[model samples]
Target: MTIRVTQPGLSTTVQDLGRPGYFHLGIPISGGMDRFALRAANLLVGNDEGAAVLEAVFMGPALEFTVDAIVAVTGAEMTPKVDDQLRETWTSFAVKAGQILSFEILKSGARAYIAIAGGIDVPMALGSRSTYSLGGLGGHEGRALVVDDELSLGQAGLGAKSGIHIAPKLRRSPGNPAELRMLPGLYWHRVTDVSGRNFFDDTWQVAPEADRIGYRFRGGRKLEFVDREQPFGAGSDPSNIVDGCYPYGSVQVPGGTEPIVLHRDAVSGGGYFMLGTVISADMDLIGQLQPHTATRFIEVTLEGAMKARRGRQNLLDELRASLD
Candidate 1:
């Protein structure tokens, strides 16, 4: 089966759970920004949770399927339509050969995942079908889909059936002034006590520069740092450190003005000092936020973070069981 793109949306790309273990070599784990949404979409279509799917950002693409297939759209509130007939988001439905699939304007959220039964059949690069556009690796031609691009679909499994839907209660979305739990890291000491308190107390708005690489926030008070002599290898700027590895979800405040939370496609290392990292459990929430959305950084302890991680895993377990 094949899907022909008649109109590529703002930025549509193929993604899976991502390719890990290559970041140390400078290859980021580029995958669906809202992983929970991606997993839900895939499961609804009877594909592996990590199966490659079309991740459309802000806008949705217009695709014409060449064969009958079970399909699901999750994550963003962008409504899907099959030949002008409206379909519910987060629910699996049927699309026959020659039926055109498109989406309505986004009502909320930032990105959406479209999962077909059996997944997108792109060749794996580094054991992943994810598209790392910056490096021109994986996915179709190592880049975003364009008009006339044809995507092959893997063989559909019997488990794929229309009408499978995730419950509204199970669906995840960003909260108003989304609360992102953060664990202070090695460079937390660099921020003064006042600035550190203010960081959490103040509300920050998502900046226009948000993307898969990282999310920048504005409208927060500038972070103040302690006065100190610059280290020999480090740059004069207080925010600069003698280059070190950047952990996924690291919140780097350059010039101590704006906090940027690095996400799926961010660089592995950088010179900027990080105040802390948004915990893994809260990272998915960041992906759903649209630019200008209000957010707050909530401090969390190591134990607390672990507890939250376990809770997240438990939710996924529940989702699978519910589907079964």
Candidate 2:
């Protein structure tokens, strides 16, 4: 089956779970920003949970299917439709040959996931079909989908079918004042006691600089760092630290100003002082936030973070069971 993009809506790109084991080489994991939604969409279309799907940012593309196809839309309420006929999200539906699939409006959230039966047949680089557009790797010509671009469909997986719907409670909603759990990083000591306390006390607003690479937050508080002599090779700035690996979701504050949370497509290492890292379970939540969204960072113990991780995994397991 083949699908053609009539209007490539904002920044639609093919993404899978992401390419791993290459961060040391400085290749960012440029997969779907919203993994939860990606998995849900894939499951609805009877594709593998990590199957490559189209991730539409803010807006969605106008697609013309050349053959009858089973498809699902999840994450961000982008009001998807088939030839102008409204279709509910978080559910699987069928699109007949010659039908046009498009999104009407972006009701909430920043990104949406659209998964077709089988998957977007893209050549894999480093065991992934994800598009790291910065480095120009993977996906269609290693970039976002453009107008008139024809995408090949892979063979349907074991349970390929339609009419699947996810429970409303299980659906992810981009609510205001998102409370993200975090764990203090190695450079947490660099922040003053008052600044450290205020970090979690104040609600930070997402800045206009937010994107796939990282999110900069403005809390109106100039964080004060503990005074100390600069270490060798660690810049003179108070927020500077010897270059170190930046784990995905790591939060760093440069010049004691706004804090930036590095996302899936961020640099692997940097000189900024990392204050903490958003827990893995909440990373998907970060993807849904838009500029000016209020967010609070709540510190959690390592054990607490682990428990949350397991709980999230269990939720996914339950979702898979419900489909069967």
Candidate 3:
């Protein structure tokens, strides 16, 4: 079976859980920005939790399926449609051969996942079918889908069926003034005590520069750095470090102005000093934030972060059980 792209939306790419263990080589773990939604969409279609699916950002693509298939749409609130007939988001449904699938304007959220039974049968690079566009690796020729691109479909598992619906409680979405819990990093000492307090107290708006690589926030007070003699190898700018490895979800404030939260496709290392990292549990929430959405950074202790991580895992467990 094959699916043909009729209209390639703003940014539609194939993604799975991601390509891990390659960050040291400068290859990021490129995958669905909203991983929870990706996994949910895949499970609803009877595909493996990490199976590759189309991740459409802002706008959605128009696809024409060549064969009957079980499909699911999740993540963003963009309503899915099969040949002009509206279908429910977060619910698996049937699409007959030659039926065209499209989406209405986005009502909420930033991206959506479209999962088909058997998943998108694309060649894997580095053990992942995810598209790392910057490196031209994986997915259909290593880029977003364009009109006329025909994607092959894998064999549907026995569990593939229509009408499977993810309960509302199982669905995840960003909250107004989304609260992102952050754990201060090694460079936290660089910022003044006043700046540190202001960071958490102030509300930041998502900047227009938000994308797969990182999210930049504006409207927050500029961070003031402590006076210090420049280290030999470090640049004169207070925000610059000699050079350091950036962990995933690191929040780096360039010039101590906008705080950028590096996401799935962010470069592994950089010279900028990071104030802290948004905790893993809250990273998914960042993906659903639309441009200009208000957000706040809440300080979290190591123990608190771990507890939240466990809660997220428990939620995933519940989702899996419900699908089963």
Candidate 4:
């Protein structure tokens, strides 16, 4: 049970939710940037939420599914075709043997998930099947998949038919202006009121300097100068002073200016403010943010965030109902 890729597009790698419980060893929670989409895709194909899936960047590779299997695509808005026909994403479907799947330029978002039944066959590293490019560990030889790469399923291959499938309501990509929500950071008051206002008021544009590791935004609106005391009152408050840990959705604002939103491949380290975390629910949508896209940060209340999370749970609840 495997599939062969004739072309691996710009970037492709295997990922699950992430490597948990090992952040203490300075292991970043390197995994899928878009957790929701990955989980949703897996659920669509009867795979566990932790199952590994292919996270494709930009367009995708042209590949042939040698084994008959079920698959689902999610995350970015890309034109995907299987056997020369358009394919529906966020839903499960069968791919006949020898069928080729091709991805065209992303139409809306920057990433997409292609989940194969039984999950993509990849060896686990550090108790997870994610790709950490910087460390060059885990997933397809510890790097982005290349042309002529063939992936195989491990134990419990897809033997059952896709009894049913559900397609989520297609979500449009956030426009050029995106008001991303953020929870108060541990160092919320570390910055001048002007800096805090700028952070929440000004719209920063996503710069070309972006990748799986993080996104660099321009026009972050400078912060006002302060007495610069022990890094306590200006936008320089770090989440922790420990050695290292899982850096998930942490926005590290360096020099009280440009803020980088750390993603899947962020480092496990200390010394940065880690001022805010992109609410877990929107991390995937954040992953889909395009280069040059403008974004604003709004402080979302904890109660409101909980409601948003529950709303997502409701969607999953409906999906489970469909499986019944």
Cα lDDT of model 3 by residue, 37-109, tens digit: 9999999999999999999999999999999999999999999999999999999999999999999999999
Worst 10 residues of 1 by lDDT: 168-177
Off by over 4 Å in 3: none
Worst 10-residue lDDT window for candidate 4 reads 237-246
Tens digit per residue, CA lDDT, model 4, 182-267: 88776666567787777888889888878888887778776653454443432334332333333567777767677888877877
Alpha-carbon TM-score of each model against the true structure: 0.99, 0.98, 0.99, 0.88
lDDT digits (tens) for residues 31-147 of candidate 2: 999898999999999898999999998899999999889999998989889999999999899899999999987888889999999999999999999998888999999999999
Better candidate number, 2 or 3, judged by TM-score? 3
lDDT of 1 by residue, 108-183 (tens): 9999999999899999999999999989999999999999999999998899999998998888898998899999
State which candidate, 2 or 3, has the greater lDDT: 3
lDDT of each: 0.95, 0.91, 0.95, 0.75
Name the lDDT value of residue 140 in candidate 1. Answer: 92
Check candidate 1 and list the clashing pairs. Answer: none
Backbone clash pairs in model 4 (N, Cα, C under 3 Å; residues 3+ apart or in different chains), count: 8
Which sections of candidate 1 miss by over 4 Å? none
